[model samples]
Target: MTNVKRKAIMVSLIRKMKEKGSWTGETHIQKCTYFLEEFLRVPLNFNFILYKHGPFSFDLRDELTALRADNFIEMEPRRPFGASFMPGKVAEVLETKYSNDIDKHKEQINFIVEKLANKSVKELERVATALYVKKNEDVSKDDMVGQIRELKPHISKELAKQAVEELNDYIKEAEHNHIIL
Candidate 1:
């Protein structure tokens, strides 16, 4: 898809996430976009790596900055946490123009947003890291938990195991719904 359409989708995602009561911080968007691309197989083309919080994409960061500049999204500061993202002035226009593109992936978007919108950043980190390990390394579920702990020593073994199990359920659900091939 074209860059404009992708930007529209990003805006739509931000809007949907906000509607679903997500914090809509950059971290939230990053993780949700990671699942949208990696788990749901959307061709968003953001190159992710296991970073400080979890799967992160500097490219997506830059795109977000550009979206802000173009008035496709705006950031609002929230006390005690950080700034959150919201749809900007022209966001609706872009969404309307690219509604078809967004519609094509709406089911996947809804699935991920529903599963993840209410999660805390720390939870996102653990689960996304679990997915990263599962996808990048050839390991069993138990071994993936070990890798998660190795990568994120801050997480407890029990939490790591739970994250891995949650990721497994997400994968199974995505597969059963044909969200992933």
Candidate 2:
């Protein structure tokens, strides 16, 4: 996949983990990645999403299965979530919400350290992406909101709504793909 696509999926998955505070399974990662590419305009790695971070209370496999059964998510590889959802109006004024507002969003994501665990470092990287975007102006509110609404059918209305806000945070956090490390 193109670097742009890969980064897009990474941003979406990370936003999901932060918004929900956790996620599980290869499929959920796959599902999130698929929609992410469409909405965020990026591609993803399912294996990267599955790589374990640490022992955690939540079981990724079980959560993925349950979420799928509940119709809250889908696992399609290349398909975007269905069309029942639309990102609502952008908040009247954008403001910092999650993660302590670090002088830099990267600083905040790095703060995510090992207290809680998800399946991958990519997840951490994704959160970093949101932080990067929130702090930068590369992504507009309209673009971010459009991406969140794309998840409407597969993810819940409430979840999608929340995701929109989370996307804003994620976009705020996303760094330029070519920034020198």
Candidate 3:
């Protein structure tokens, strides 16, 4: 996709995330975009790695900075929780210009946002890390949980299991609907 199309998707994500009552922080955008690319295969072309919070893309981070610089998104301070992102003054114009491109992947975007928009940062960390491990490692379900716990010792075994289970459900649903290839 073109760079402008990618920006449109990002703008739409920020807007929908806010509308869905998400924190819309940098971490939220990072994890959601990770799922959009990895799970739904939207081809945003971000190279994600298991970072401090979860799957993080430095490229995407840079793009977000550019979006802010270009007045396509605004950072709003939320005090103790750090700053959150919001659609900027020119966001709607970009969205309008790339409406067709955005619509092509609308279902995938909405799927990710609906699944993750309301999750707490901690929850996102656990679940997204589970996905990272699942994608990057060859392991059975039980081993995946063990790996998740090992990767994030802060998370309990039960929570890791739950995250893996949730990830499995998402995969199954996506496959059923032909969202992922």
Compose the digit string of candidate 1's lDDT tens values, residues 1-181: 7899999999999999999999999899999999999888889999998898989999999999999999999999998889899999989999998999999989989998999988999999999999899889779988998899899999999999999999999988888888872
Off by over 4 Å in 1: none
Q: Name the TM-score of candidate 3.
A: 0.96
Query: TM-scores, in order shown?
Result: 0.98, 0.25, 0.96
Count of clashes in candidate 1: 0
Q: Write the per-residue lDDT of candidate 2 for residues 78-152, one digit (tens) a residue.
A: 234322211112211111221222122343223231211343434433332332333334555554434433422
Instruction: Judging by TM-score, tell me the better candidate of 1 and 3.
Output: 1
Q: Write the per-residue lDDT of candidate 3 for residues 71-179, one digit (tens) a residue.
A: 9999999878998999998898999989999888888988899999989999999999999998897789899989888878888999999999999999998888887
Q: Candidates sorted by lDDT, descending order?
A: 1, 3, 2
lDDT of 1: 0.93
**What's the lDDT for candidate 2?**
0.35
The CA lDDT of each predicted structure is: 0.93, 0.35, 0.91
